[model samples]
Target chain A: MSQPQPTVLILEDNPGDFFLVKEFLKRTSLPAYEIHHTERVADAIKLLQEQEFHLILMDLFLPDSEGIQTFMKIYPLAKQAPVIVLTGLVDEEVTLGTLQQGAQDYLIKGEYDEKLLEKTIRYSVERKHNQELIMRSEEVSRKKLEALVQERTRELEEAIKKEKLLVDLKNQFVAIASHEFRTPLSTIRFAAEYLHDYLEKIDEAEIRSKLKKIEKQVTHMTALLEDVIMAGRTDLKKILVVKSKIELRNLVDKIIEDVQNSTRNTHQIELNYNVNSKEIDTDEKLFRNIFINLLTNAIKYSPGKESVLLNIKEETGLLIITVTDQGIGISEEDQVKLFEAFQRGTNAASIAGTGLGLSIVKKAVELLKGSIRLQSGLNEGTTVEVRLPVATTENKPA
Target chain B: MTTRILLIEDTEDLGENIRDVLRMEGFNVVWARNGKIGLDTYHEITPDLIVTDIIMPLMNGLEVVREVRAFEKQTGVSPIPIIILSAKATPEDHAEGLAAGANIYLKKPCSIDNLMNAVRSLIAN
Candidate 1:
């Protein structure tokens, strides 16, 4: 029976040494043979790519490439094949060097007889197969690790984006808070200084106005702080709409009175309430939020303008309130993001505003199952209309 | 004659306070609540010196400095002294304010006396 022959590629420059190696291999247990021989390392590379060899018998020195360079050149191209380096030099140092750099074993020529050669060839073939197995497994594990790293990177990027967005929102909040607080605090400081520095000479009317300014500023500061807190709570879904029986007429009147008293300007706000229901089941805090936002917006926008018309009426079971301002109205573009948090109209940009008023108003309206609309043109005027379904006995703002 | 100064601040009460204090100090001060309005008031009053906050809507302090510099260049007038009053106390902000043609950059919550001194020094120069 013919033994299963392992095909070998021998890279050697010397013809005598090549023939001797070939004869030695023929006497081995690998009897039937297909031995490919190349004198040049480059030629051996081309042959290795074209054909699959079980093992390689290579001379470290060649005409085209020499020593470590020769082996390095063909080593990668000779994929999955175990190399047995045959050296005529017979020096232990050089042979060991090639073996260390991935040649499976080295044979010193004329010294290795048939049995030793046979044993070495068998060992080289077996060792190469095992080495290939280890390499293949390592390759698979490396691929898995790479894919895992890529996936983790993607997840981390998404997390970072979300974190950056939260940071940006927080930064915007801080900046707004600083600007918002500065107003009332400065008002109190200035008013107090006025009272302190000029108390004796100042008349009762002047002292009263200064005190009123301080009072108004305190109210404004409290409201601002409350709004900021409410907004934060609302974002966290912590603030729930609390519904109770509220005197709608009195609430409207009270807001009107406060707004009028607080406004430092001489501008008037004409409130016309034609609601039939005096009492309604609604959230008072939410109601106040919507009313104050609209009312303040009206007053603030119309700085030097005459009167703002605030009209509340019941039509088709829906209570509708519209606050009309003759101030510098918003442009078409600016109105698009007007209800977005921290967004202000282009014309209102220079004006002292937290840009939270409209946003809060929109949120409050949504909670009450109501809708708010804005109508404005550049240089014309602004009108904010809010329509809420009158909450009766069982109905509640959720 | 009182030194006319344009006080540009976004905060209304702050602007009012500064105006009152400046008035008490016997300076003719015209207050504007933003860079754009401040520039407009500058055109109106042609004040001897300008005191402006850094961050404001419409036009910021940097924009104001750039625009005012362009105006000065066009008119062939002695450059108006600009003092930046900002909450940004960082060295970078200070350098940027000066590079934008401001003569002085003062951090906010400044003592009224220090602000007056800065105003006086810049106006004198």
Candidate 2:
């Protein structure tokens, strides 16, 4: 009713032996088969390469290969097919050797009747199929294990790299912080030494001047520590943006006054604004931090230069602000890394700054739904521009 | 003769303080606030001894030492004992300072008395 399940191969050189096998098969009650008869081992190898066979009836004595080794040549090629050796009476021991080398069973040339031959072929096919299934499953498991090992190795490599980076970052932080700590400590120590060396001979003016130096150094150190803490808060993801209504012109004016009071830098900060009363819903703390950072940068950079220009425009519910300094600007290479945390400009190494100012400004601006850009070049000057959408009660920052 | 010392540091207050202590300890000290100015002072004064800070604008301390070495090689001047008084505190930093041709390396926040002792020993030799 359907196609035969087993396609049997016969590799016998003798015609009488081949005829006896055909006669035995013809008398069997088994299903009809597509049998291929090859008298040469070479021809059997070619047939096995060309197509898959279910069962092989092989003779150890072939046209080109003889004895137990004759089965070895065809066995590798016809591994998909189960083999049964057909042997004469004198070669019974050699036929058993063939069975040991992956052949299923053997049939005596003149002695096997129809029922015994059918039983041998049926059981050989079953055993060979089970062996192939076991091999396929083992091959699959080996490949799966290799892939899993590769994936785990990659993950561990990534984790190790991250750990190394974190350690390097910690060392870098300690180095920078130690420098900051020393400057102020040196200042206080100097003041103490001056007083200790000349306590009786020094007048009130000298005492007042040294005390003022100590106070100023302490203030500077406090500001630096606060910046470090702010950077830590950003690293910890602890900054919360809460919206409050603020007047834009007053805020700028107030920040400018505070910078003037705190800094001894004599650079005149000019605010170019006509609007005095434009109110918007924004986070006041974030806004204050951003504006003050920009103003400090402007005043600090424009050291020999006279004026810092802060141009502000409030139009169409958008605030565009630009702060320009005619100070020593950043290089083209350093500008790309300027907004990254703990990165400083090449020209600012001698300047008393912790390199956290711009990064904090960047994060605060992002939280305020704003964008910041810098136009700077070496010895040319720097201009930092910022844009923020004036959100209403309905429109807000995330 | 008063031993003249050239001091290089970036921070204005710290430089003044260190100079004050050295001047009080009977050394004629000339101070410069940055590396470029300090290098110029070295060329101009050719002081008996030199003290410097490492992290400075323009030239930095190691660059100053290297340039001074080159200058001494060109002119064949007597080698000056150089001391690195810096904020960087690490054994590796100290080793680098020595390798850069400095005779002494002292980390910052050092007491005035300790600094005076170092200056006295170096200047006396």
Candidate 3:
């Protein structure tokens, strides 16, 4: 088989030594090779920069450079090529030093024959090629390890953030729960104690009023518990969206009636229904809770306002219900976190509330594939608009 | 002269119950619905003792205490004994209430006996 001509650069200052090395290379029984000759290190470096060679045969003592320094200058420019040191004397220490500093092999003058020189050149080229292969693979593995470490660090940071959010939510829940429960409990305790200590002094009418206050407190506590349980159910994804055909107007009327009865009908709620089709396929229980919460909130927040407006209409394929109150409105800061559990408006702090009403309403609306919007300013008024897509004929239960 | 007490609380039922109990104890009790009104009533009546709830609209109990302290400092009158009744039961909350110049901090739902004792002791002192 024929072999490609191997290019060689010979850097030697002495003309006689260069001729003898060239003669030895020509005598070797190998394939034809190309040789480049330069006397000074500067000219050799220029040639090394311009052209790539298969092997570099360098003399230790050049006109511009001497000893190990000569190899150091040329070694960087050698690139992938193997460098063989050619020395006049057989100094064991100097030869070992050059070898340690990445010199492929060292040849002595008047000692090595053509055969030894040929073998040395072949072995050095092969060893250098193998070393380059090992280095390239090591580089690839190092990059891969770095990328994997960065990805793991990102995932750990995300997990820590989620853990911190859960802890914050837990703390907020504890504070709200403790505060809400204690107020009513205190009232019950005070009323019971007052009656027990002053039973004879207080008449039957006063006794009945004290007992009634206890009952009212117990009812308030029960309602608070129910709100907590409902919130938990929604959080745990336990509430299922069961869509069925129902009269939307009737459902809303029933809800309004219940709210008015509970609130003692203090405020007049004017309902305006403007829809041709009253039937809608939706989760009845979720729908009831959503409007119940909205209507109750409208009445509760509008303390002195005599009336609230509930407008229901259909736009495109969506059913839009808006409950507007002409009472103390929510501030921009409070409105931002209005849907978050246990968040209450700063102005509404004095009002009695579990602060779970709006969050629960939001979750219920989300489950029904709807959206809610609120518009209000501090002390102006609040209007809550909920848009829910009416299920088409295909989605209707058979 | 009656041992007059100024009671500050937001909840109607709870406020009424406390007022009735204090009235039954023979102390002339004046109830204010919030911290702002409570502070105003404190100046008007100059009651023997002040019992205030911590969380209320217009102003919080701490602010009222600070304002009352500042007023007393300026007027050179003897500071009225103050007690804080609140649902905030955390150690940090207690520290804050006392630090705000309240004579005593009582968590909500405290026994009526405990409350009467505290009120009597502060008034007596």
Identify the leading candidate in terms of DockQ. Answer: 3
DockQ of each: 0.17, 0.39, 0.42
Lowest summed lDDT over 10 consecutive residues: which window, candidate 3 chain A?
Answer: A389-398
- List model 1 lDDT by residue over A324-384, tens digit each: 9987899999999888777778677446678888888888888788999999988688999
Mark the regions of model 3 whose C-alpha exceeds 4 Å error after superposition: A1-8, A14-35, A40-54, A60-70, A84-133, A191-247, A261-266, A275-285, A346-349, A352-357, A392-398, B1-85, B88-106, B118-125
2 or 3: which has the higher TM-score?
Answer: 3
Candidate 2: C-alpha RMSD to true structure equals 6.3
lDDT, residue B102, model 1? 93
TM-score of chain A of 1: 0.59
- TM-score per prediction, in order, is 0.56, 0.69, 0.70
Per-model i-RMS: 4.2, 2.5, 2.6
Q: Comparing 1 and 3 by lDDT, which wins? A: 3
Predicted complex 2: CAPRI docking category = acceptable
lDDT of each: 0.81, 0.83, 0.87
**Higher-TM-score candidate among 1 and 3?**
3
Which is superior by DockQ, 2 or 3?
3
lDDT of 3 at A267: 89
